[model samples]
Target: MMINSTQVSYFTLSAYFDTGLFKYLCFMIVMSLYVLIVGSNLLLVVVICMNRSLHEPMYLFLCSLFVNELVGSSGLFPFLLVQILSDSHTVSAPLCFLQIFCVHYYGAVEYLNLAVMSYDRYLAICYPLQYNTRMTYNKIATLIALTWLCPCCAMVVLMSLTSSLQLCRNTIYKVYCDTHSVVKLSCSDINVINVYGLIATFSTIFGSLLLILFSYVRILRVCFSGSKQTRQKAVSTCTPHLASLLNFSVGACFEVSQSRFNMSTLPNVLRIFLSLYFLTCPPLFNPVLYGLNLSKIRVIFKSLISNAA
Candidate 1:
């Protein structure tokens, strides 16, 4: 596709809500989802914090996952929630950059956190004797800190590249600020750089996914080698992790498909769906996978209600 330098910026949103009834209904639906995601994740974090039993290395990872959900959803959902409510969906250049930064930053952080959690599980299951010694409280803290730092590095590279592009006045089509959307607006010939950036993005995400998969496979093999009780316990614990991994895998697949397809060929609805699959759904599911399935959480949740009463 050729770039038109004269266009500068396009500030238009599609007629997604031409019907007033549909508009109101969509607004209510989105508001409900935002409330649910934020409320559930916050509750998970609180439960982890208040329960002394939940202070172990495993629950610490759960807490981190909830935090990632909170950060990721907060970065993307509120702006989208507003857009759903209002008839006007126009966004400015500076605000667009802010949105892009927040989305990618939280997203990168979430990926890094998941990778760390995989490594934690690997240590606990594959190297039981060294698990406690290797994954001490301070060491876990260091892992979490490094996860945060990795995102900072990714943002530095992505933002620097995107910020330099001259977005010839083309506004984005998607509900949220996406990298592909922003890059498409650049007036200059960004084919080579954009391709390179997309490859780098995919490589990081796919590489992390591969690492997580490898860890889990090895974990399963180790568990199977143990006795029946140990195998069952490992399976029970891994069920939740597997659920999260599946959700992430589906989301990542959709994201890559959308990025690879020619925008003109893919319908707008599919584009929106793919974006939501990756950006919205995975964050919403993270807390549920890590928190609700645990017995400790069930006990803490019941106590919270009784105390409230």
Candidate 2:
């Protein structure tokens, strides 16, 4: 299939925020958000690591979570910040591929981290006695390693497959790098590639979420059969994770949908607004939701403050 003939070998992007006022506003907002996500997640990691009381399977997973959150955010935020502030948002072919790979890599890791965390909770709540035995330091290390490895494995396959494809010209509709956006740009036969990518992503997402839901259901059943206080505590402990999963799922769905359909029905401003919200909101909320809502984490924060004072 011949693309529209053009001497231009690459497509350059215009800044999403064309107006000076909007650019400055977005720069400030996104910068503030990046700082919050990085700061809060780092603090959470330190609190978990520095305190011997938190040296358990559960907090171990939380620390892994903070690291994953930072990894995921760093994959896109710095480049995005530059793009948002610059006169041009254009990126090169190699950089575009790198962006696409990093996104799926860390994004998939985030999902896997959630699954590991859910399993950790299940063991802690449902089988407290066996928790230590089942989730030893070595076991926790394996889980953390898997969290990073699984995503890296997928990304390597995905990038290898995508990089092999011939891209006629780069026409990214969205502000940031997205898998489908990059896939759609391929001039070669992408039918099989798209199908594989779609299946892999959907299976990873739906499969992990299904397992989490199943574990939580059993957890709730066990809690309900026990005491009322036990039930409340279990539910509260699960709330932050539930909220995080929900946000992540919603954002993924929106991103996939926007990629699938031509989003021309909505105005550009509204489209960009939704995209930005989906991309940035979940990471920012993850640490806050857990830190504020989980009593243990709140106590840790208090101790951290008291010790500092």
Question: By lDDT, who's the top model here?
Answer: 2
lDDT per residue (tens digit) for residues 162-226 in model 2: 77777676767888876677676677798878778878788778778877988898798889787
**Model 2 accuracy (lDDT, Cα):** 0.78
lDDT of 2 at 102: 72
Local distance difference test, per candidate? 0.74, 0.78
lDDT of 1 by residue, 1-309 (tens): 344654444344452445566767877877787788889989888888887888888788878877877777787778776777777787666667777777777766667667777878888878878888989999989978877776777677777787678766565666777677778767767876677677766766776788788888888788878778767766667778778767876886776666566665766667777777866787677767666677778778888889999
Worst 10 residues of 2 by lDDT: 1-10
Please identify model 2 stretches exceeding 4 Å from their true place: 1-11, 14-17
lDDT score of residue 274 within candidate 2: 68
Alpha-carbon error at 276 in model 1, in Å? 1.0
